[model samples]
Each structure stands twice: as structure tokens, then as C-alpha cells.
Target: MASPVLLCVGLSHREVPIAVREQVAVSADDLPEKLRRLKAIPGVREAFLVSTCNRLEIFSVADSRTVADDLLREVGPAGAPHAVVRSDDDALTHLFRVAASLDSMVVGEAQILGQIKDAHETAKLHGAAGAYFARLMAKAQSAAKRVRTETQIARGAVSVASVAVQLARKVLGNLAGRTVLLVGAGEMAQLAARELHQSSASELLVANRSSARAEEIAREVAGVAVNLAELPALLERADVVLCSTGAREPVVTHEMMVRALKARRYRPAFLIDLALPRNVEPSVNELENVYVYDMDDLERVAAGNRELREQEVARAEEIVREELAALRKADRERSAVPVLARLREHAHGVAKSEVERTLAQLAALDEKQKKAVQAMASAIVNKLLHGPTSRLREEQGGPLAEAAAELFGLAEGPGADPVANPVANPPEGEAADVLPISGRK
Candidate 1:
């Protein structure tokens, strides 16, 4: 029997705060690099990385827990003690819940599902994802679409982006004549740009290391594009700065921002640093007339969204529970394959031994008579074993499967004889070997 191809070991908003998640969230552009590092681990076979402001997770299929450990190690300080792990059916349930935004700070937020899709695609392009992961993600995505369409989950309260925009409206009263400067061309920045544009902001500037990408996003939003070299100058002129670049280090350091603040004569600047590892420096918050809001600060805004959608959240949770139960049931069924194989081998071996014994006892009989006796014994053996065989087959995929397999000596070997084929039987009473993420058994 093959090992389960479902495993998830990583942290998120619930387990760790934004401070830790920011360090680990693989940026969209460099996600392939992170995926490569994860796959290079010994046990990992197929892998996908889903990274968002709310969570950073690695979904994979592996032979042992070591693969998950290796991923955490490779992610360095970013994945440390904060990263949580799950395996088999639990991992599948986690992915489904994540896609449905049931695992989000604000439940039913739709942005995460799209981020997961993008992450899966990025992994696919790099050969990090295989057939199993692709199928799993497809199923999860399908489930998310179903929940969104079938229920009120996505009707009244839609997305984190929209919620952020709503908060901005409440804060500044009006966006007219305000200048919004987007620090990166990433998805979060783009979403913010869309919101700002829709609110009829007077001007927009997109600054990025890749001027072409900046220009690309800028054109879409009817904004101007600037190089990273020009951000210092642009920062002084903008009223709102949404920073979400891919730099490992802080792109908007406190000192540099202080200089920009001085240039603007300490005027109030609404800064939303939406990057993980945070694009803006934490110290920048101390500056007067500079209101800096990162993901952590957004929790207050998320809480507001949560309170608004309290009634709808119950429905989403119910849907997630139903889906998770079905997935767990399916997993238990797959886990029973080894026991069924073992039972079949044991029955065949006993029948063979009985035939040999009866043949020796009937040596004095004629050849025809001996053959008749052997055939009769064979039929009787088969009939006697029929009930157990049927039961094993029928119970292969239910809740009782694992306990039942352990109770029978049926889970003993790879072949008919346990002594002769010890390797086939998993270490006495141990579970069968599962396939690792490395694609080897």
C-alpha cells in the first residue's frame, strides 16, 4: 500500500503573530526558490507553498516528519518554533479550511483562495507540485468555489482588500485629492491600487525594483510608474503609501523615512505596509504625523469585519466541518490497504499448507482419490475463510478499519509467509511504509 499523499506542516496567523509570519511568507516572485529549497529536503516528494499576509504554509507529501523539519530548517529563522505541522487527513482538512478562509483571522475572506491558486501554479511551474498535490489543490479550490457560490459566505462581506479600503475610508473620511504611492507591484499592492483608484484619488505612483512590472501595474490603475531610485522623492509627495515589495530587508527604513518626513514638513502620511518581513521598518511607527499600519495593526480592522459577518461565519464553519469529515473518512479507508493485503496472503498460505498435509495422509489412496480429497479440502478452506475475506474488503475504508486491522493478525506480511517475507510485513505490528515526498517508498 502506498503512503498517504497528504501532509501539511506550517504556521499561520492563529499559531503565530504577524511578526513571525512576515519573516516566513514567501513572496510571490521568489516562491519558486522557496519551493526548491523545500523539495531538496530528504523525505519531501511533491510540494506547494501558500503564502499570504495572514499565513505561510507548506503543503506536501512525505515518507516521514523529517521532510517537514527540513522545510522549517531551510526557511531559517522565519519558520522556527512558530511553524505548526499536520499530516495525512489532517493536512487535507487544513488546506480545505484555509482555502475556504475558515482558518483566516476574518472568516470567509476570499483573497486567500486566489493566493493559494497562485501559489499552486507557481509550484507547478517549478515542478514542485505533482499529480497528487495538483489534484488536492483542485479539489480544495473547487470546494472554496462551492462555498462562495452556494452560501452567504461571500455575499455581504467579500474580501480583505475591500475591507482594507473600507477602513481607509473610515479613517481619512474622503480620498479625493489624496495621492496613493504603491511601494511594489505585488498582488496586495495591486489590490490597494485598485481600491484607491476606485475611490477617485487624485494621483497614484507605483515604485518597484522592476520598473517594467511597476509600469505594468501602474498603467492598469491609470497611475505613474517610478523606479526604486525615485521612491524617496515620491514618498514625500504622497498622502498614502502602501508598501508590499519582495525585499528581504526593510525597503522603507526608519532613517530614510525620517528624511522623507522632514521633506514633507511632518505632514500626516497614512502608510500601510502590507509586506511580510514587513516592507516598512517597525521603528517608523514612532514618528509623529506618520501613521504606519502593518498586518498586525490590521487585526483591529479584521475584527470589525468579523463582527459584521458574525452571523454568516457560523454557516461557513458548518460547511468546513462537513467537508473535513468526508475527507477524514476517505483517508481512513486508504490506510486499510495493508491489512487487506496481509489477510489475503495469510488465507492463501493456510490453504497451501492444508493441501500438502492432506496429500501426505492420503498416500495409500489411488491418484484419483487423492486429487478428489485435495479438491474437497480446498473448497472447505475457502468457504471457511469467505466471511472474513468479505468483511475485510467491506471494512477497508471506514472508521473501524484501522482498529480492526490491528486486531487481526492479518496485517503481518508482504507475502504468504511472514517468516520468509519479513520485509513485506511492516516491523511486526508497525504500520506499512508510506511514500515520502521524495517520490520513493
Candidate 2:
């Protein structure tokens, strides 16, 4: 009966440098291994990790603060300054905010929702998700959808691709004559290619596993289609490579790119990898005269969307606050369940013992009379406990109820049960910063 407590530790693009985030980036392929390592820690009943270019986060359910600390230590930098540690309500609220894009660099971009869903599924596939985390993620998803539907938060032209193109223009002086090599041909890649094309990139080349699909996208975008085999050669020719393939393995490995670099004789190339599994290898980032960026690096470009999304900030905040209050109320109501259950158990124990003692003392009575006496005792017990039971159910989180619980030994003391009455009497020391969950019930 260990109380379930959630822990969230994360580093985002806003907080850390791209180099740091990339170093700590848990690729989708490595998630299961990371989760296994996390669950092996002391008191960690369950664990999950969600890592994208914009954010890298670990969510876990544990019985002790030490477990959460271990999770942070494992996921965070040895001396990282930017990582945020959240527990309890704060963890829940942060997750909902992230899912809703309120915590994203681009406030209402739809990409984070898909990323969150993918992460959640990854956790489930690895057996890291249990009842508590599953319930929480479901609520977070629903809350995000509600926020999008009920508010104007998602309205307008906002996306990571547009932002990236805008940022590229800022860096490259002009995008008009740039040669853009489009890799992967996925939704994000298509979007980036479209944005670059619209921005007047002089030449566009689409290279993907499926030549036909690449051709289709290229034809539609008025670009040239090249076979995936030509990627290395194409790498030498393009000024910018926008890669967003679905391959779990890196399509552009460091060795492959090293040859391409040698072939091109060290020309500067901007490589943008937008795949979740990461189409480009991490080591390719080390290539001199090459600028490598992933989804996490896009945060710089996406940051501008924050200003546009600010127009709907008030409405979104109101929705979040209102939902948070309702969730808190429900959580408060649930806290009463344990107390009432304890009271019932105490009353039943007292009645059973007293009845047994009375029956022993009334040995001279006939069997029929004993049965009648037993019924009478049961009735008296029920009548005596009815008022207290009703009062206990109605007096949730009140001083009277807490006092009653203390006297009855219903509470296991501070930090022993996180889900008990956490918001009421938060634990001292390490558990003090735990926040309330602000998700929909």
C-alpha cells in the first residue's frame, strides 16, 4: 500500500543550450532501456521518459523523495543549472501545461501533443506505464484537447516549420538562392520544404526511402526528386538539409557525412533533423563547417510564436485554472475515502469484539435468546456508528476530521501516504515542493 507520488524532471530548450540538450537527449530507441534503469531504482514503482528537441522529461511514480531525486540525478546533468524538479500537483499541472502547449516555446503549436502521445505510447510499450501514470496521461490528453477546443489558443498560422524558416532567413542573410535538400519526406519535412520553397529557396531536392513518394512530394512542391542512395552525394551539393524521416535508425550517420564533407571539401551546410527517432546521427553534429540542429534546436525559431499565442493567453489560463480547481476539489473529496474506510473498520472491530464478549457472558441464555441478543447488539452498534460515519463523510479535510483521524490512528503520519491528504498537511523537508495535479478528472 505505498502511496503513489509522481516525479517530473525536465530540461527544455529555453533552459539549456542545444549542446547540453542533445547530450542528454534520450532517443526514442533508447527510451525502453532508460525506463528499465529508472524502475530499477529504489522505491520507483513505475517510470517513463519523454524526450523531444524542445524538451527532455522523465515522469515516475515512487514512494519516497529519494526515488525522485535519483530520477533527476540520472536524467539531469551532473551540474545542470536548468533542470526543473516537480512532484505531486506541480508535476501533474506541468504535464498538462506541456500537453496543452502552454509550456511549449511555441504556445499552441500542435507538434507537442503528438510528441506527448508518442512518448506516452513508448512508455506503455516498455511496460513503464501503470494505472496511475496511464490515468494521468489520459487526463492530460483530454485537458489539452479541451484547451484547444474551448479557447482560441490554436488559432492562426503557427508551426515549428514556419518558425524554422524564419530563423533560417535571420541567419543566412537571404533564403532566395539557397539550395535546400529535403530528406525523409514526412509531414514535418514536407512542411519545412514547403516553407523553404515558399521563402524562395532557388533549388529543392527531395530524397527519401521511397523514391516514388519523394517524387510525388517533389513534383507537387516543384522540386527535384532524388533516390535515397544519392543522399550522400546530394549532401555535398545542398546548402541546407531539412531531414524528417520515420527511420528509427539514423539515415545520415557520421561516417557517411564525413565522406560527404571530404567530398565537398569542408563547405558549411545546415542540417535540420526533425524526426522523433532522429534521422541524423548525433556524431554528425561534430563535423566542422556544418551546423546540425534537431527538433530541440527549433525552439529558437519557435519562440516567436509565443508572442502570437499571447493574445489567447488569458482565455487559456482561465481554462487551466478552472480545470485545476475542479481537479483539486475532486482530489480533496478522494482524501476522505481512506478516513471513512478506517472509521468503518474501527467500528466493525469494536462491535465484533464487544458482541463476542457479551455472548460469552450470557452462556445461561438459550440459543434462540442468544441469537436475539446478538441481533440487538448489531442494531445498537449500527445506530451508534451511523452519526459518526455520516459526519466523517461530510467533514473532508476539516480540522475536526484530521483530529479524529489522529485519535483513531487512521493517518500513518507525514510523508507516509502522499495520496492521503497531501494538500492539507504537506510533508516537511523534501516533500514541501510537491504540487497539486491540475488535470481534468
lDDT against the true structure, per candidate, is 0.71, 0.74
Spell out the clash pairs found in candidate 1: 22-277, 44-437, 44-438, 45-437, 45-438, 62-436, 62-437, 63-436, 333-397, 414-424
Model 2: per-residue lDDT, tens digit, 179-247?
A: 999988667778878889888899999887888998899988789998889888898888788988766
Best by TM-score: 1
| Candidate 1 per-residue lDDT over residues 93-137, each given as its tens digit | 678889987777666767888888888888888998877667667
Q: After superposing candidate 2, which stretches have Cα over 4 Å from the reference?
A: 1-4, 76-81, 166-180, 184-187, 195-204, 208-224, 227-241, 244-301, 366-376, 395-404, 411-441
Separate clash counts for every candidate: 10, 5
lDDT of 2 at 354: 86
Off by over 4 Å in 1: 1-7, 27-37, 40-47, 60-71, 87-90, 118-135, 156-158, 253-267, 335-345, 356-375, 393-408, 412-441
The TM-scores, one per candidate, come to 0.77, 0.74
